[model samples]
Target: MRDPYIFSRMHRIPGYLDPGDALILRALLGHQNASGYRGGAAEIGIYYGRSFFLIERQLRTDERALAIDLFDAGDQKSGRKRLESFTERARDMGCVLSEGQVIRADSRTLAPEDIIARIGRVRMFSIDGGHGLAHVRADADLAAATLSPEGVIVFDDFCNPEWPEVTAAILDFLRANWDRLRPFAVSQKKLYIAHTGIGAEYGAALDRAEGLRRLPRAPVNLFGHTALRVSHRLWQRIGYEILCRMGLGRMSAMLY
Candidate 1:
């Protein structure tokens, strides 16, 4: 069996992930091997630090994490600044970052070579970066190039209309790279992976797509693995409206 560099303590984190996600996480942790792999994890976007805290709880001193984000301002500069501040405020709650853990940058420049020079090949790569076709495709390519054999690459906000490009690019990538990649888990909004396990998602291709669509929304795993990684604030606003009506509005939001 291949090693799966799993984290033991991350299951107890308070936000984002659900019981199902914890179960999946445990499976990842219980598969570690003595191979020379460092087996790391990352989050492309850290909006409020909830997911960062979760990852930090399971991280070792030697294991590195690359948190890619702008942190200052995007379309909603005020919101971005507030989120950046809130993330810093939540540091004391759990998995605190001291220094060098956070990389304040966009995912576009996060090339495969950067992974080599900075974080090395990872065991789990959580992508909540930009949702545009260009950004998602770039991250997918980077993950495809640098992910370890037994590693997992989870995409946040996989099939949202706001990021139509994300859905398009990922579906296209998975179809083309089915031999090396596979989709193992799907909630309502986010899609999880086990690599190679995705097999030929044939006979179940529509099922696969529909399954990915049915994944629990980000308010569930946004803090764990599946992020509400949308690039458009307009769509986010609408989603928030529905979530508010559904009573999931007042929470910390399982943001990526």
Candidate 2:
């Protein structure tokens, strides 16, 4: 089932997740839920709950979702305000941010146990906390440690030139833990990873997902692994261009 909240309301939230990546995530979450994969969902760096909200909406009432951020670590005043903004925005979307669900600390300081204690084993974990090499490595370790046997992790800005360290860190992590974790899919903005054995299962879900345009080209080679590449449809791109010319590019993107 398509999520009305995502198609109609997600654009209003501020963040960097591409629409194509969002579509891919929704399909993966659907596949996980349908296959009876039971575990919590989580995001390490939730900026205003944009991408995190997509994960949160997929959780069962019995499951928990954790938002770990350095909300006030840099500066108490600005941090507190940032946390408040996230909370208010979440509440407006009908999700009340409980004290237990929100962990206000640096991702680097957190051990896997700290996360497991709060949300148990995660089925869908997003690592967008920091773009620095050390930051990505630390967050990746935390995700791998707390991930369920068949869980998946989404890494943001994997190959963006603006953050070359993210790509380097992910490559190093993947090389060290290739047997444990394998990437399945790549969107314009995120890399979808899963347990090496079940990586194909998630990739199949994307292949079967509707409204997503897979590039006709062959799968991408990331290191020794292969991943399917997806992007917006041609019609969607044309619509986006039309909207851009009309000064409604954001709205067009949300709709297309």
The candidate maximizing TM-score is 2
Q: Report how far residue 58 has shifted in candidate 2, in Å.
A: 1.1
lDDT of 1 by residue, 1-256 (tens): 1111112222222234432343233334333322233566677766664455445445566776667777765425354464456454556454455445667777777677777566667777777778888888888888777786667677776767777888888887777776667675554455666566432231133232221232232323422332232122344445544554565543313221
- Give candidate 2's TM-score: 0.88
Tell me the spans in candidate 1 whose CA falls farther than 4 Å from its real position. 1-27, 30-38, 74-87, 94-99, 197-256
Candidate 1 displacement at residue 146 in angstroms:
2.3
Candidate 2: C-alpha RMSD after superposition: 3.4
Off by over 4 Å in 2: 73-80, 211-218, 233-256
Expressed as tens digits, the lDDT of each residue in 1-256 for candidate 2 is 4466555566666666655677778788888888999898889888778888888888888888999888763324455577777888888888856788999888999888888888899999999998899999999998999999879999999888999999999999999998789899887778889998999888877787764544332378877778887765677656745765566655664553
> Each prediction's TM-score against the native?
0.61, 0.88
Error of 1 at 151 (Å): 0.8
